[model samples]
Target chain A: MGKVINGLDIESLSSLLDEARKNKELVQKISKWYARVRWAGTGFTFNSYVRNHSFTISEPSELGGPDKGPNAVEYVISALGACYLTGFILNATKRGVNIKNLEIALEGEIDNILVFLGISNEGHPGYRKVIAKAYVEADCDEKTLKEIWEETVRTSPVGNTLARNVEIVPQLSLIK
Target chain B: MATVVNGIKLEDFNALHEELKRNAEFVSKIHKWNARIRWAGSGFNFTSYVRNHKFTISEPSDIGGADSGPSAHELILTALGACYSTGFIYNATKRNIQIKNFEVAIEGEIDDILVFFGLSDKGHPGYKKIVVKAYVEADADEKTIKEIWEAAVKGSPVGNTLQRGVEIVPQVSLVRK
Candidate 1:
């Protein structure tokens, strides 16, 4: 794990960024991000630890949870939306576009658990579609901004997973 | 706010398992999730609002912001990992497996922001693959536990997107407010 350092160590990260810019293939820096969740008998909520941070996730009371925190579904939207926004920031910065302000909204629709319940195979239980809108403020004209946005869809990994077609393979490990 | 009332409480969510076993389509319920994020300046940090859950995410100090919270990338993994764990617990409880302890860990590899930096377009900047491990302590044998694990994967919504594929659509707007 990298030290917390003096904030974001943009110097080191940028040096890495510079190296990546020079060596196209060198940019293929492989990284592992981790998240851990433990479920104790606490109102059906899980204490999740991620990158030295801990938070709680619980379903609605209708589902028998204490409703103390956001549900898993809410987190999904947060991830996708934030990922998309990050792309914009990265691109605008690289392009030298000064962003005065920026905001993004993300929404996804998924059937409640029909597939999860194994009762309905007619539609995907996961998000059938995700819609995201990024409201950006920058000095660039709309035409240039649109171009940046287009580039973002291609560059943003999280949004790309949703914007265009990509492949994700999942392997599960079980310990008894 | 729905009163913190107790009704049809599944007593450890086992009620869900029985429902799934009886009728598969019983899962046809639908819900929408929403979030709004804003970035004003410094560190590319973003403040997010979701169902009254307020938080901020900033770039590592290296990049600028105060490192207020985990990067978006970290949150992505957290969402996936937590969702998968939820699936396992739901499945195990449904299977009547008495879980002594339960936990899950998720790890994935994402290409550096070279692509976003306009450095390289040779590869996908997102995760190439996700590896998940569940440490489950239950009264059942390994075989039964394995079965429950499979069941969880088969039903996990987050895992399904990674295992299968889902479409994400994005729209961009320029607004002052």
Candidate 2:
């Protein structure tokens, strides 16, 4: 219903990162809570969302995931879309960009082989590069809207993750 | 490229947990369903392991798609749902406030109109909305369940993002070609 914005008041999200930093206890608890909840490696990060109840998503269909779950790229796009949307609302709340309806369309282009092989020495395999395209309709002028959009992406946590290449530092050393 | 770091805390995690607990509808529906998704970009993952005639998802009666591979949205929803579910379950179990079954359901509408029209835009103008419904089946009765469901939607990561609007940022850098 309402969002609190301060341009760089990401303290709220930082707390989540804190949880990841202190994930030793939580990881074990999480795995025990649900056997399906498995921790693949260290450096735990949280990217949460709701599950789709409609179609059965399995392997080898379209998104390049096996018959088990969604491919990471699609998830990336979702995260981008969701993060962009969150930034939009937060910034709008902060800047008081009234107006009305807003919609976003996001997609990424990826290579097929890299993803399937699970050997992205660079990053994502299938889609070597993915692009997210969003359209906005608001009460402000095109120039204003464009500026706001740029700011949103600049601040988006997920967008920042994709826009920049990140090196993971493992806090916990696994037995393997 | 600009970089931003996010850190979650017990308080934040608990807040998200409470949100999902309140939104019982989304919680229950998602668990019952399964998706067969494929990574179309480059390679295959675990889902492929099973679909390629290798393993099993659940029991033999375990529900699965005859044809493997998931649509784009299906995969998105699964990730979102899984995150929510995992987070919810983790927090809820820690709180010891659970009873029975829980599920999360996400429904999305995407538009390829720009692609169809060959128009250039940062994002798609066609994708209208994606609706998320959470369902909960618990021994706590209906009223408590309702409260929990409400909390979940209000605080859950995915729900909050869906409820909030998305912002777009476009940047250009000069590179020798």
Candidate 3:
């Protein structure tokens, strides 16, 4: 059995890296992700599905929802934290660092809710900033861990997506 | 009885909106959200906590995970769809349009997965583009419904978050064993 650190199979990860390095086609391929959501016939509540998994997305009681689950914005922040942690662990394992424990806490601040509520259009209704704090306990030096963290953030998919302006195409089909 | 449109309590939503308009402090104050993730001591699996709820996050089996749950990218797309759907319903309800059915489908294309795996840095590992399709059956006209959809897209929190750049501050605390 190969070395396992922080619940990651380093040997398997390394072999995948090697395979990608050898096959240029693999590196050139693009991966696609999808999700579907339907209104659950309630106040600001939705049922979201991705692959074989499903979950509830709803607002708090203050926002006219049953508070069944976390709001969509909260899910976004959670997804960001999860993506960053995954990247960090993978990078650390690849570097042969044994991580004892790891956790990432994230906070996202929306710029304006007034715009979303249609009360005003002074500013965009989106996250103005997102902050992430990573607490890592590992058998490695602080400097090395910081370097790995930087690399993880730099290469993180969700991190890059949020940090940059990407294209969003919206299509609408009305049923009369 | 209070007015209910598209399953939304119009009286309550309008009351909240009026209150916000009266109190600019509420509108001006930033709305902050939080989430925390902890490694599950397995292959790229995590337990994510948001508010009082918890769920699992994992990669596909092909990527060294047990495929117990959806990947982070998938979650992002789902979040976007949910946000857009909420925005749509909210707007439609406010306009007094009765929606019979509504759905939002989200698709995102990654620039390159190799960058995420640390195999290559040819391009960014983030999504290159995202496409959202909304299917709605409503009592409103086509043009009006289209306008509402556009407004919803523009006002969507997750949509705007994905459409524009946001500041990300990262910090690390090293815990010595």
Estimated TM-score for each candidate: 0.81, 0.35, 0.95
DockQ of 3: 0.78
Report the C-alpha displacement of residue B78, candidate 1, in angstroms.
1.4
Which model is ahead, 1 or 3, in terms of TM-score?
Answer: 3
Give i-RMS (Å) per prediction.
Answer: 3.8, 19.0, 1.4
Per-residue accuracy of model 3 over B36-106 as CA lDDT, tens digit each: 99988766889999878899998877667778888888888888889889989888888888888999889
lDDT of 3 by residue, A76-176 (tens): 88888989988988888888888788899999988888788887787788999999999998888988998999999999999989998889998999866
Candidate 1 lDDT tens digits, B34-153: 888877464467788887777776554443445677677667677776776666666665555656677777777775555656666777667766677778766778888887777777
Docking class of 1: acceptable
Which docking class does model 3 fall in?
Answer: medium
TM-score for chain B of each model, two decimals: 0.78, 0.45, 0.94
Q: Which candidate is the best by lDDT?
A: 3
Candidate 3 clashes between residue pairs 3 or more apart in a chain or in different chains: none
Residues B30-110, candidate 2, lDDT per residue (tens digit)? 212111222121111112221233211110001111222332223444544544443344334434454344554454443
> What is candidate 2's CAPRI-style docking category based on DockQ?
incorrect
Task: Return the candidate ranking by DockQ, descending.
Answer: 3, 1, 2
Q: Can you list each candidate's DockQ?
A: 0.46, 0.03, 0.78
